[model samples]
Target chain A: MKHNFGAGPGILPQEVLKQAAAGVLDFNGIGLSILEISHRSPEFEGVLNEAVKLVKEELGVPEGYSVLFLQGGASTQFAMVPYNLLPEGGKAAYVESGVWANKALKEAKYFGDVEVIATAKDKNFTYIPKDFTVPADAAYLHLTSNNTIYGTQLQEFPASPIPVVCDMSSDIFSRKVNVADFGLIYAGAQKNMGPAGTTLVIVKDELLGKADRKIPSMFNYQAQIDGGSMYNTPPVFAIYVSMLTLRWLKAKGGVEAIQKENEEKARVLYEEIDRNPLFKGVCVPEDRSHMNVCFLVENPEHEKPFLKFAEERGIEGIKGHRSAGGFRASIYNALPITSVYVLVEAMQEFAEKNK
Target chain B: MKHNFGAGPGILPQEVLKQAAAGVLDFNGIGLSILEISHRSPEFEGVLNEAVKLVKEELGVPEGYSVLFLQGGASTQFAMVPYNLLPEGGKAAYVESGVWANKALKEAKYFGDVEVIATAKDKNFTYIPKDFTVPADAAYLHLTSNNTIYGTQLQEFPASPIPVVCDMSSDIFSRKVNVADFGLIYAGAQKNMGPAGTTLVIVKDELLGKADRKIPSMFNYQAQIDGGSMYNTPPVFAIYVSMLTLRWLKAKGGVEAIQKENEEKARVLYEEIDRNPLFKGVCVPEDRSHMNVCFLVENPEHEKPFLKFAEERGIEGIKGHRSAGGFRASIYNALPITSVYVLVEAMQEFAEKNK
Candidate 1:
């Protein structure tokens, strides 16, 4: 009955974990472990196919887009996005909202010129930077939808003149997005999806082949699309587990249904953080991420005590990132609202004890 | 009762599978699934550390080398190798032993000049080319230690004036090799190591940083070494299973013991292939792989019937690659000699029935 709140490589549905465990022993009664089967095998091909289909169905992805399951997490995408989309000597616009965004822009610099059109770095990224112009001359505008460390999110995507490449690593599928709005959306599966091996890349088919750089087969979005994400041996088991998780999401009535649950979970948790005198929210109210609710204790001494208290109550991974030193309760799609209730109860109990 | 002989994402030890399943359910009694735990958690860090240590110990990797568990399989490494090693306008030599080697060379061309010094393509890669001079002027020489599709392996590593980078994907832990001989050795963890998703890179420290190109952090060996293969969220579960498999290998008396067993397995299977009137070995006798035993039906009509007969006895994944038509029984490290005996018995019985 432990509540998992770790950010990225975060919580997954219990049933998905059980099915994944069972598959590791005997996948679909084939007497073969999922970990031992060939990716070319019909069984694994089916898993990869279903996983891609679920991503499309869950996100309502338009037909003109390609959904890819690739390796190397979102960090790899920081380089890949520019490598594929940004042409030689072309510039890409970036909004540096957090550490990840800063890293993304830095990687983009290796390929071509980068313009930091907007950033919330001044306030330590406590709010998403909204007032910025999308440089039309730029090849693309790169954005981080949710800053996991800073607990801020782009509440609404800005209408851009050029292609928008968003790193939705932390908050994908927690809410619905118009697939047609962005040229590309990449998310590491560790958060709100499944595990840590595979990355989900949804790219507009037309946005590719414009970079004019000689891209390696693995890094080329078109190459991956042409191979149907099997250009080489894919991260098989991770894709399989992700398929299981997506199946669980579909069974729970898809992304729209889960989005409501996520909103409610964040609502209650944030409400508790606000009402309790000992705790305070970390980010601006409007920009606060529903996926990760970052907060701080008013009395710094209460931080250690509250963490231990939460742990005793089966609350785990609530500790904030070292960069943002307080607490962060990540309410991913798989994290049940009941777990949020438990956290709320613990917070209240701790507040009462301190008083 | 089933014998898995898939080329890769191949068989893992049953005990390793069981433990992996248990860990997926509740990793180390931590009340969290291994898939759900943070990569930075002490638990997973311990797992990653032990995996690196085990790779070093099992391979007798000298202190000057680094062991990296990366993602995107060997295909990714094809580009990464050249990206990190081949400097701007520098020449690298490659041996085109098989399809994989051809692909590796193709990737190298993207970075700099790639010279194919030796090739077995004339014989459909039926043998390993032995006589080739290592060009002293080249930055490094690339070689494929074993060709999975062609069933040919380099029985002896060639002495080189420059550095040697080898793709040992299919035969890494099946036998021991001197780490000092190579500048870089990378293998996708599917054949002899673990499942698909992770790649093992063992590189001599002195070979890095000479490539005077703006190498992205993920592809740069120096950055990866600095981060200790945690440059990004590595293929966590894949690395975990690999560690478990390596641990299993160590307990089974490490690579030296496995080599003898692998040799015996290959000996008996190849002996059966030679003895059977209906079957014939695919590659040259001197160069046949101990890991992937490829053979052809003397009568083309016998191929399907022989496959069915083998399948009836619960023999799996023995079908040859489409390019090389016949059968391929991959006797990887985790595959027991008993499984080889089962495959050999099936071949004998099939031949008797045909006779």
Candidate 2:
């Protein structure tokens, strides 16, 4: 079996894939493919409802928040967040942790004044900037919870006076976060949740309708909330697969239990990276992401050979991003501990040969 | 043997569904689920490239046009069209043919001045408004090619001095269109193309970057074209299924062949509707939609029983929209003429029982 370590559109539980495939043929034994049913049909309404309920239960989401399974990925949310929250001429604070954060801030600039409270760009985003001040005058403070490109994560959320809009696209549901702490949380489903089409948004109800901008119906969170996420023809198949994935997550003891497994997966893999004489971790020890572990070979020449060596042993998508030329084994929530062990073994064997 | 008449997320070709299911489990022998693979991966890039190429080939898109597979459906395009084409303080002329066209024009108001040059609302959208003049000063004239809810379609497109933007959500590839006649044509894939998550946009490349407003990257057609519709992680599974459906279409002799089949399907169903003493067509004869055939019971009491009668024969989703208050058989591109025969047979049986 191939061990997938792709970052974003990463690994999913095998059972989820099985069920999703089954649904594509005949959904819930209804003699209809899930892709063929109307969004307004009771069958699909049930799927969407159950998915939302699972999200609430899995995250222990407090009331007064709306959970939406919307089309477009986190990239859409980058603009939508500001469109709904930032008023004309209002300033929004941003903490640039990595490339994704930089993109988010750039989108926010189109809507209003943007204040870069902290940035790690000077050091090529190797570490998450910790000493950042969130201005109360700003409409909201945006943060990237996990950096997929550089393998950096905010270990602790910064306490902010204003509402916090966090992009947790890479690490959502891999660990627990108090739902009450943030005004808005959006994540593309490709990472820990499900697939690439749908985005999961948990927005504080009171945080909307304050921007005073003429928001389009699709981009308006309030409109989506009012319509129960069926404001228009939603990404039906994407939502269905996401619902199945979430069901799998729920069956496996939810986020809390998955967190322990994810931590162990990252720990064992990172431990091997440090212990191996030929390998080295990329990010600072304190900020290295549990979701994506970035590392490199001591001798740059070993990179190509090590990648091929890992691929031979059925390891896939371990090659790092182009911006950061190294290996990034994204051990997302669905990645089994066995896959990590296999990668570690491959690394150890490769180091032995190289030395 | 289910005859899916659902108005989107409508029926897909059975073969396409099977292929999509297989891809969900293991895409192209890659041993990784399509949902789990990276969108940037060569495998997925191939799928996306083929999808674009198929669209260009099927639609006979010209050199100046770009085919985009975007998320957020037609509703998002309602805003994006105006955001990209209509400049601030400019006016967009709209032919308010149906509810969808009305909604599209409403969204345009958020960006600039809107002129409702023609509307068939007085007749409850039972006919397409034909006598509308396109103002030369208007940025663009928007029209809905097929009205799904009302079962009305523009049999002939209006001659426009300005660029014409059309929403073909319900009837995109059901027939052939002169691509050069329109500036932009968009369709939610759930109808004639593939499934719900992705939308197909064929836009004139020269028409973009004309609006003097700050269009967000996700909504900006220029940015999407620049990124090759990979401005962000696209709806991968949706696009994959769409490509498969398009491939199926091409193998069936492309749009020209499908259009003939669609014409036959509409003709047989409408003939049965008109001949049956208990049923009556909803829209004006010349304006009836080929994609969605809406009709009503002559005696109002027959409506529920007819729906139940159809359902018993394994005919699903034939229930008309609530606003229309009748029955609608959405014979989209994927629907076989045999399914139309079944529905017609059911109608004949129902009328015989009533008589």
Candidate 3:
């Protein structure tokens, strides 16, 4: 069996993929592809409305929350959230965890006063900063739930005096989180959900309408909530596939069961990296990402041969980002335990051959 | 036999959809869903490279013109164009044709001196404004190639001393045009390309580093163009499906042949509406939209019955926008000639029964 470990457009459930393949040509035998249907029609409305409800029920979102399926991925929400909530001269505190965290913070600066409360920049973002107090006067405290590139994760969120906004693009639905803990949560539907193009935004209704500026209708929370995410043509096929993936998540016992599987997968790979003298995990042990495990060899010479060996053995996407070179294995919610076993076995074999 | 006439995210060619469905599950038998593949990988890089090449070849874009497949719809570019090119105090001339035109103008007002050179509001936008000169000092003269809601199109683009920036969301690739004539052209992918979530931006390479302020990374044209649209996680599946559609466009004799077919399809439907006394076209004949043909019933009492009759005959998505409150037959690129025939036949039966 082939092992896939690419990040963020990462692994998806096999059953979800199968159902998505079938639905593209004929959705429930409607004689029209899902891509061809009108978003306003009852057929598509049913799909969208159910997906919204599932997000609420599965995450235990409190009542009066508005779930939006938007375009431009999590990157768009970096600007949209601030545009909708930041009044003129308003300030929001942002924690810089990784590349995405820094990008989000930069976008917010365009609208209002944005304060960087804490940053892991000194350590090359290898770990999440801790014990930082959020400003009480800030509108919201923003954090990255998981960083895919540097293999860092915020293990437990710190208490915030203000509302919290999270960019949970990488680790959303991988673990059970109290959705009510934050005022706003946004995720791109790529890693744990379905595909790119669709972003899932869950916002508390009360946090909206504070923006004094004239927010673009497309970026406005009220526009999306009132229009039911169909204010304009939505990313139809991506959303349909996401609905299927959500169903697969439910069928497999949701976040609780998946978290156990995810933990075990990470354990096997991390243990192999730790035991093998030739390889070293990049991130601090306390902050290694459960989703993406970044590692490197002691000698640069072993990197190319190791990558080729892994590829020959049906392992793919082992290369790391150019900025932080080495290797990465992305074990998302849908990655099976068997794939992780294959990766671990390959690492063991490589160590034996080198010795 | 099924006909889908939903405006955007509307009908796509069946062959393209079928191939896309197969790829969604296991992209070329790579054992991974296309959604999970990394954009940086050679596999996805091939997809992007080929897609850009096809767009350039099929659209007849001259050398030095860059093509970018970005996230967010054309609406995002309304602000991005001004943010990137409009120097702090620069002025841009805009033609107010319809809703989208006005929206773009309003967004630009936030940045610089935005001049509304002409407006079709005097004629209720049923016809395109004529006899207006674009200012020489303006950064760019902006226009909407086709008004999706008003059912009007610019048969001939306005001559301008400055570069032309167009929002070609509804009617791109419907006809052959000189790509070098415009400074920049952008379109949301849903209407005629594939699905929502991906926006196509084609701009001259020389049009860079003009904005005085530091633009956000996602909105920065140079950052995206330099990164090859992979500066962040792109809308993968929407783009993959677009590649398939673009491939189909190439195999079916490119945009030139499709344009002929599109014109014929629009002619058939419009002729039938003109001949029938029970129906009257909404826009003036000189300014009718070949993409969206909007028309009203001769008598208000017959509207409900005709709509019901069309629904019963398996003719769908012909209902007009809430503001118009009539029927609009959207004859996009992938809409079959037979579907237009189906709509024409339905209109004939409704007229005979109620006339």
- Docking quality class, candidate 2: high
Per-residue lDDT tens digits for candidate 3, residues B103-171, read: 899888877889999999887778888779899999989999999888999989978889899999998
Candidate 1 interface CA RMSD, Å: 0.7
What's the CA error at residue A235 for candidate 1, in Å? 0.5
Model 3 clash pairs are A9-B36
Candidate 2, B1-355: lDDT as tens digits? 7899998989999999999999988998989999999999999999999999999899889899999999999999999999999999999999999999999999999998999999999999999998867899999999999999999998899899999999999999889899999999999999888989999999998888878888888889989999999999999999999999999999999999999999999999999999999999999999999989999999999989988899999999988898888899999989899999999999999988999
Clashes found in each candidate (C-alpha, N, C closer than 3 A): 0, 0, 1
lDDT of 3 by residue, A1-355 (tens): 6788887678788888888888888888888888778777677888888898778777888887899998877887888878887778989999999988998998999889999999999989899988688999988999999998899888898888788999999999898898888999999988998888799999999998877777666778898899888767788778888888888888889888999999999989999899999899999899999999999999999999999989989998889977788998999888899999988889889989999
- In TM-score terms, candidate 2 sits at 0.99
Cα lDDT computed for each candidate against the true fold? 0.93, 0.93, 0.87
Task: Tell me the TM-score of each prediction against the true structure.
Answer: 0.99, 0.99, 0.94
Q: What share of the true interface contacts does each candidate keep?
A: 0.89, 0.92, 0.73
TM value for model 3: 0.94
Query: Where is the poorest 10-residue window by lDDT in model 3 chain B?
Result: B210-219
Interface RMSD over true interface Cα atoms for each candidate: 0.7, 0.8, 1.6
Q: For all the candidates, what are their Cα RMSDs to the real structure? A: 0.7, 0.8, 2.3
Off by over 4 Å in 1: none
Q: What's the true lDDT of residue A55 in model 3?
A: 84
